[model samples]
Target: MSVTALYTDLSGYYDLMCADIDYREQSNYVRRLHELFGNQGKNVLDLACGTGPHLRHFIDFGYTASGVDINQPMLDIAQLRCPEAQFTQQDMSDLNMDAQMDLISCFLYSIHYNQSIATLTDCIASVHRALKPGGLFCFNAVDKSTIDNRAGIKRQLTHDQSNFSFQSNWYYSGEGEQQQLQLSIERTTNGITEHWRDQHAMVALTFAHLQQLLEPYFEVHILAHDYERIAPWENAAGNAFFVAIKH
Candidate 1:
């Protein structure tokens, strides 16, 4: 399926469906990670910065913020949300920036969009090259174990004139190394209903595998859960957060 089409359909309702997310708190946590692991510079880049809520927070906190995403519709919304920052249309796997950043963040498990280990490696390499020496990279991912354990889930929401519903299911293929998230969405606005369905693929990587992949270009600093610092193995919930520094 075309990911661009899926996101284009979702762009208008993205923030509505994600109303539960506390972007301020999440951004504060990202800032804290930068303070703990970064070089204390103000230049920051947000990868896959959909709708720019987190980027707006970084800007509010006085960072020289910039954002990049593959979807132009999403970038359009982001540009409106944070006019002070630059927004670019680019894929994470082949990101190019004229200036290196002091910190780079890919939040909300956006790294999983790479869909394959080879592409994920390319994405990480791009990020490494985009970061200045001692710069920090922070991201979160769903562990393979977590993907293996997922069950079918459903959600519904109503915001203003739009009503939204989504059903999600998970599948594993290729001897459990690849995971897929199947999403079915229905949106009704002003009494007009639209349906969209898409399956997104991700390369399931264990904490050790991800660490090994990054060790070549970055100093793996922390692997925790839910933004709290903890041992990687202790994260029974399958949500993993990572902070690394470019060597």
Candidate 2:
């Protein structure tokens, strides 16, 4: 209940922040990838699974699903959203699993929440250890090298009599292994308005560096970041999906 800021006490507003995302398409794409390059099992572990939107779809798709997040408030909402699935409070960087998963996924670039390259390495290792042989680890990521500090995405929506505006962008200083996800939110209702801003630290790396980190534990494939199509990463885009199979 102490979630004070974005992804924390403000967990109740999480869904509103992501109302524009197409969860169904993202889920379907991952399922398609699993069918093409996985152990063909149904057990899945969703990392940093805020509000469990993807878990909802995964359960509906007949997978035995479980989710882990650092925010308990988010987990509470996720439990209500997908009562048939299991939820846990845990940091994904040092993930612990009771059983091996057939697939482990981190969506919306949440993998970067590990916050530092060293921690991200730990997360990758943890994912490798928690997955069964040939199991898949899938996630999307942005290249820090391609980050445009001046570019951002903004949207406005009306929900339950309240109007909400959300802005988010990536900021990289052109060096180092650090980046920031800068977020700003504004909500107005009946002449009352409130504002919130947060800067989330993230691990910054090139796809080449990330591939090197995964090579020791998995067979890695970098694919275009398109939920509608599965194709190799063209090396020209700022975002891409990483699909790794545990060796």
Candidate 3:
């Protein structure tokens, strides 16, 4: 399926597919980061804001939230989930906005969706343009060099009389600036089973390279990927939370 069709088709199941994610902890943790590193303004934006799960929490935390996504179907559901917040269908790499924000976030490693280093550079520039001075741009990412091709995650759930099995992994070829997110889902209802799979293209770079990309636009900090605690990222770790302040 085409990219548009792929997201539209999975929009309904996206939340279910991420049932194991602790969105509240993630949101609250970011809120804490904002309190520490942000401009203290209430206006905020979420990039690739699928289903607005984090937006809902941000709104409840007293933020005036807005979101952007490439998929209209996801935005439609997000509108229902966050009626008071604004949303637009736009490519994040080409992000444009009339309103500046104090805090901008892209969570769940969704920053990888930019597809290429050139576009990822565009995204960083766009984000800098969208933020107020002293504003924060926070997100999580993984170093391509540390990706373990043999490791993956699997989980199962039952909903609406259907059993769903979800599996996902990150794969890198031990070479250039490209990676893939391989995902598959299995649904079984009434003894009939259906399977679906997709491989998403993602840009690959080392943490040092990623830091170099953000340095021109922001004051960059690489933190350990623990949402519950604020700590520096040790050089050996694979994944990290990046907090950048607009320069």
- Higher-ranked by TM-score: 1 or 3: 3
Query: What is the Å distance of residue 75 in model 1 from its true position?
Result: 0.1
Q: Give one digit per residue, the lDDT tens place, for model 2 in 150-200.
A: 999998999889999989888899999988888888889998999988888
lDDT of 3 by residue, 154-227 (tens): 98999999999888899899999989888888889999999888788888999999999999999999999998
Segments of candidate 1 deviating more than 4 angstroms:
2-4, 149-153, 174-176, 189-193, 228-235
What TM-score does structure 2 among the candidates reach?
0.97
Q: With candidate 1 superimposed using the best TM-score fit, by how many Å does residue 57's alpha carbon deviate from the native?
A: 0.4
lDDT of candidate model 1 versus the reference: 0.83
Q: Candidate 1 or 3, higher lDDT? A: 3
Question: How does each model score on TM-score?
Answer: 0.90, 0.97, 0.97
lDDT of 3: 0.92
RMSD of 3: 1.3
Error of 2 at 48 (Å): 0.7
